[model samples]
Target: MTLGNFSRVTEFILLGLSDTRELQILFFAFFFLAYAMVLLGNLLIIVTVKADPKLSSPMHFLLCNLSFIDICCTSVTSPRMLVDLLSQRKTIAFEDCIAQLFFLHFVGATEMFLLTVMAYDRYTAICKPLRYTVIMSRQVCWVLVFACWAGGFLHSIVQTLLTIQLPFCGPNAIDNYFCDVPPVIRLACMDVHVTEWLMVSNSGLISLVCFLVLVTSYTFILVTVRVRFTEGHWKALSTCASHLMVVTLFFIPCIFIYLRPFSSFSSDKHICVIYTVFCPVMNPLIYTLRNNEVKASMWKLWQRYVEGRKRTVTFPGDTDHCILPAINSLLQYTSVIISTMKDKMHKVNTSTVSEFILIGLSDAPEVRFFLFVLFLIIYLVTMASNITVFVAISTDTRLHNPMYFFLGNLSLLDILCPTITVPKMLEVLLSENNVISFSGCILQLFFLVDVVGTEILLLTVMAYDRYVAICQPLQYVNIVSMKLCARLAIGTWVVGFFNSLLHTSLIFTLFFCASNEVEKYYCDIAPVLALSCLPTYSRELVILTVAGVLGSSAFVVTLVSYVYILLAILCMNSAESRHKAFSTCSSHLTVVCLFYGTTICTYVRPSSAYSPDQDRIVSMLYGILTPLLNPIIYSLRNKEVKCALGRVISQVRTTLTK
Candidate 1:
């Protein structure tokens, strides 16, 4: 029973997946192809995701990581298994067996953790659409990946330690094909009840817990998708279903293999092969075939290659002199094609307006006074709150960081935002003069667009800041330098300015021979575009394209940043550190939800669905309420801000009393 009393076995004989030579040959060929497919398929996924900009969401980002893990997992098990199938001996040295065991468990555990993280990602995307970007930023994603590897490494070390500690003296025949805790633990000379129990608890219990949590999370997601299906809901559901399929494939085999007693191993080798080789091969198929986006991306890539070949295929014969001549012909042909396209396009109107009327929030005489008083109070409070935060962040040395710097910029925008329209709104409500000049409307729209665009970029920057601070803390100062911060800040404003210019120019270019009265309280893009008598198809296309780029770009940036942030936070050893990190982002996250949610509702729809009452309410959220709530959200959730506010108040009181 003791180690000194037994002769340690120096080698082990693997029975392989089959015993007979014919069956082994069959197994070898099948596994060889499967292993090739696993490598090729995962490589394609990694390459496709990396190469395509359209596939730059957090979901795809994690998919890339998953594919990489699958490659590592398959490489650890399949190659050796294939070689053993052909060899007569099928023997593995003691050290080689331990090495295989270590790697298999390591990659497998890493993959398990990766899959669970991916489930959380799907949950975020489906359940919390608005906050998805801020929640799953790039910084968060990287951190999650690191944590996955770290967890896997720790787990593998424990398992390998347990298995290797057992003295293998007599029976050197392992029933299964590969080195795993289950089959190998049975060959120990001593009583391995304690080891088996530990292995079961480690791998078995962990797999079960992860599987249960994955199912539970997907259950909520399915419920949500079923109840409130939208434009892209089916795509989301398909993705979740594919993930669920994969989860089922991975966990069922794992539980069956690991959870049972060592003596219970009957035909589990068949199940083992399913996970070790077959499951990995199926992942790319499930993800790519079921996913329309990935399929389209693959198709697009194929099409581009075909088109590139077509463009490069030189006119049937090519001598050295003809190569230059062919190039010249190609350029000439391209120019002619471009000219022909331009000739077919119709002319667009480019008219300008002198003055216009604004049909503000309300026209009822009874509520005019009340409405004026209410919004006046709101405007005053918004300005006061934002200004307070702006001042606090400016003066407080403790708040001098990239996050607070961005916060200060947001506060300033919050103040300027309401100021652009609230004054005119209050005037219109009180005087019942719902008339805004054309120049004035354009000016108001310009600032609105500018501020909105700037805010989007700012949110993205804040996410990046959080990513660097949490994920790459050592390089945070060097990367997010004051000079870099200034450049980013200035760049956002400049981009917003140009964006507003393009939109305003496009808006005014349309002939507005219709009524001057605007529908909503302020001159928003959609409402103003509706009044243009001329066909605004081109203008609409331009607007949609620009807005799409801006919105989608900001979204991807934020999502990628938070993905890394989430990963980093999850990896933190201490609960208090995680809580602290989350708290730092909570305020910004809330503001992101409020801003993006309302903006998308207002602008990202057709004019046909535009409702005045609904628009006003939604407008009030981002315009008035968001600004009003932002400072409150920051001051309340952030302890530093609260303390700073208290100090400011104390200073003011002391000054007054003196």
Candidate 2:
């Protein structure tokens, strides 16, 4: 067991699928397309599930997870394999080989457990239809998904630990294109009999068990459908058919490869390719083609995207020609900034940071639990209230005016804004695993800024809508047309997108060679910038200059509109008219104050005055409380919204009963 006994191989040569130059190129081309399809197909599934309200069931949620895992599973090996296919030397470092093996089994085993879970979900839905919702409730679904991931981790860790510990002093060329248990273990410089058996039991046994469970579940489903010959039974059987196909394709290959000694078979590479490359590519296609709901959602999503593109391209008047050039210039500017920052980082070698540790809200155990529960509840309520508001606006024609349209957009933001931060905050509070990868932190910060920026502009737009309604009631119809509303909404989102891109690029371009601890619950611009090793004065200045110009412009527009609105309200002769007008603007005004007040306090001050604890609390005010409060404020104050919500609820009830 001692490493001093022999030389350890530092890398492994992969013979790969084919040795011919033409064959390698052909393999590369084929796999590149397969990988692209896997990514695009699975991404579409995820986006469709998230966007379509009708697909908000537990089943679709699990499908979304499956799609994501497929993407991850393929990405672990496919990219490297594709590269090696084109390279002269098909070799991977020992550490990278081990890492690749770790993630391969990690996602692979997770998919096994997930497929089994999906089978159980189908079983419950088909066999126990009466208790389906209760059995597969949102909480239960989350737990099941978490359990699948944990189980995968445990399985993969055992395999990895056993493999990494063995002495690999010679025969380091693996027969397959990727590192795997059988091929890698065969190269170890010791007797791997016991180790191979352990791996077979760990991996092969698990696959066999999951496969058997799925078979049993589907057998029962088929029997139930055969015995009761009903339309519902037939429909359930059709759904299970897709899961059955996926299980067969995924598990059979896994069992074939893992259920024996570490002996090389000529067919091993082919079988490995089936599960690793083909299964991931096919799962999304099978699901989308077989499942009507997913197909419908995808079609709707595509239509929405197409409509949005048309709206973006086709402006009202001669504005299209003017706007196209501005958009192109903005895109060019973004590209220049990104390329410039990347070059600077490369020259200075300042991009050495790998990950960040967030010093979350509180470290005390007692307070951590309290904060977790508090934020969890807040997040759930935020999602429910915002989703309800969005559904109401979409379904109820009575609430489809420009005011409700903007409100619907706000509700969507409320859902998105908290979602970006609160889940991570809760995880930090509960598990204390506050480390986020560098790319992850940048992404979180980018989205957080984008949503916040959009909300600021949206609030200003909402104020203008009110001003048109109250101050210029006669011109409101002509001024606040749907086309104009669409343009304004689109503009806010585009501006937010560019604004976030600029700030995120600028902040990350700085040297982060010092501490990588973000001193807040989640990644934010200020906390992340605070950790930079280089001077952040220029970045801070840019943030301030942009925020000041944008924020002040929005604030001034809102203020002037409100000033005119107030004058119009006060000039009303009837008290009833005044009350109606005030009620219409009250909810928006309250949200505006909450949003602007907290954001200004957090971002406008000098860095020397920044306190982590104080900033955390202030961030929660806008980040957490504002989203939670928007729906409640609007729903409680506006009778029309309340009525729309009631109608939505009744419609849902009706649908469920049917």
For residues 276-374, write the lDDT of model 2, one tens digit per residue: 889988898789867889977887888789789988876546666666787898789878877776686577645678899999877799999998998
**Per-residue lDDT for 342-369 in model 1, tens only?**
3432233333455677777666787888
Q: Estimate each model's TM-score.
A: 0.51, 0.51
Could you tell me the lDDT of residue 57 within candidate 1?
91
Q: State the local distance difference test value for candidate 2.
A: 0.86
Note the Cα lDDT for every prediction shown. Answer: 0.81, 0.86
